[model samples]
Target: MATRYTADEIVERLRSEIKDRRPLFMPNCGMGLSGKLQEKGGSDLICVSPTSWWRLRGQGSLAAFLPFSDINELVFEMAREITATVDEVPLISLSGPHNPLLGHREHLKRLWEAGISGINPFISKIYDESFCEQISNIDMGWENEVEIVKVANEMNMFSFAYAFNPEEAEILTEAGADVIASHCGATRGGLKGAKTGLSLEEAAELSQEIFDAAKKVNEDVILFAHGGPIEGPKEVEYIFQHTNAHGFTGGSAAERIPIEESIYNVTKEYKNVPME
Candidate 1:
């Protein structure tokens, strides 16, 4: 039988563990599991992909990517490694394959069996039906605001924000998203004139809009802003206060610094929201 974890149980475990040991804020640190993340952040580091979105999540420094056939096996191995190094277990979030709905629901079932804290689905332009198809059983994915509300409230998970869309913020707030995130600093920007890299300023400004919109809908909805070029602790604080996101998650912001040093500085200012 599939191991079913209530949202509350997941939340409680995550909260308790993090409260004991600070949660590792993993981001687009590298291709496939990064040793840097493990070396500094420890086992709590989540490994995610798409090089665009769902960047902050982690699932330990994977020796090999999470293969659907034996995802649980991978998780067990990673858990062992993390525990060995960190000396304790912390919740890890995996950035799943492009679409959770891609394979049969069995994939999700296996993932659940692996005992992951969360899985973030990648893919742009997701609709309700297509979105529902991806996260049939899983709680979160790359969903729109309408879908975010449905997933957050019904499934009891969190989700991403529509890229720079203020309107979508309203939808996410209603969905019960504990933290609102975005991929403003991902790798795949269309490369316009000068092939400009992803901009955290754009992300920050947009996050402010999302924050204002969500507040208009409901003030309690906490925001979790992300992207690259955050620069320093002051920038993190600026974005957090400006965008109204209670937390911020983006590695490139401090890619230059030692990973642990960066996190110590960043999390000292902000925190994270639970996502799947």
Candidate 2:
């Protein structure tokens, strides 16, 4: 059976865990990746989305290329898959403002009823509509993004903001984001032109800024870092030591990049092995 947690209860649990210094290692995942991560002791949070789900299931090329309307069913299907495949770890839906379904409160309520524990309404600031043709039509303004977060909070879903800078971070917190993630652009091996946003050094410097801004509004909000310079446990530890963020969150880094390398290496080596 699926476990239900209110936004406040989820935040309280996350806060207590962070207070104990048990840093969160949330990785974006779907069915296949969730199963692998779960077998390896699991993540503190698992981010579920159409993109990652499709990618992990061998339809990755279609993930970024598909539109929100086209992929919404896949997203919901993946959510049900996670409910069956993963246990304990909070499943946060990584949605966007362009999402046709999540733009309304009733749909958000339906999502919660379907067993999703949280929502991460990620708004891409740098890309224009033309630029995002490969991704979805994520043309939501800051106010639109904030309103989504507000509705998610109103629904009592654990709301997370995927902010790339301190300013966005501040706005999201004020708009009622329970968790604010400094989501730098994707790193090497992710989508084309993925290496954008703050450098690791710059992100470390901005962490305090994000933390201060968030704390000013919601003192109990959780801060996390994603993508860019952060990869693996060492980088995660470095971010924790250098920044005010409590944990690290990964998507391609935790799912695609490593999987690509491992699968490629293993398959290549098998070619060298005797097939006869």
Candidate 1, residues 91-150: lDDT per residue as tens digits?
333334433353424434454444433444332333345755665446444453245235
Task: For candidate 2, give the lDDT.
Answer: 0.69
Q: Provide the RMSD of all predictions against the true structure, rounded to 1 decimal.
A: 11.5, 3.8
**Candidate 1, TM-score vs. the true structure?**
0.52
Q: What is the TM-score of each candidate against the true structure?
A: 0.52, 0.84
Where model 1 places Cα greater than 4 Å from the true spot, the runs are 1-6, 9-108, 123-153, 157-163, 187-202, 254-276
lDDT of 2 at 262: 85
Clashing pairs in 2: 55-60
Model 2 C-alpha lDDT per residue in residues 1-276, reported as the tens digit of each score: 346678888888787788887887677776744644653664667777766766675644335544634444565777776777665667777665655445558657766777777777745454565654544435444556678788877778888787766677778988789888876666444432155566678767766677777787778788888776776677777788888788787776777777777888899998899867
Q: Residue 75 lDDT in model 1?
A: 42
- TM value for model 2: 0.84
Model 1, position 259: C-alpha lDDT score: 47
Against the true structure, whose lDDT is highest? 2
The model with the greatest TM-score is 2
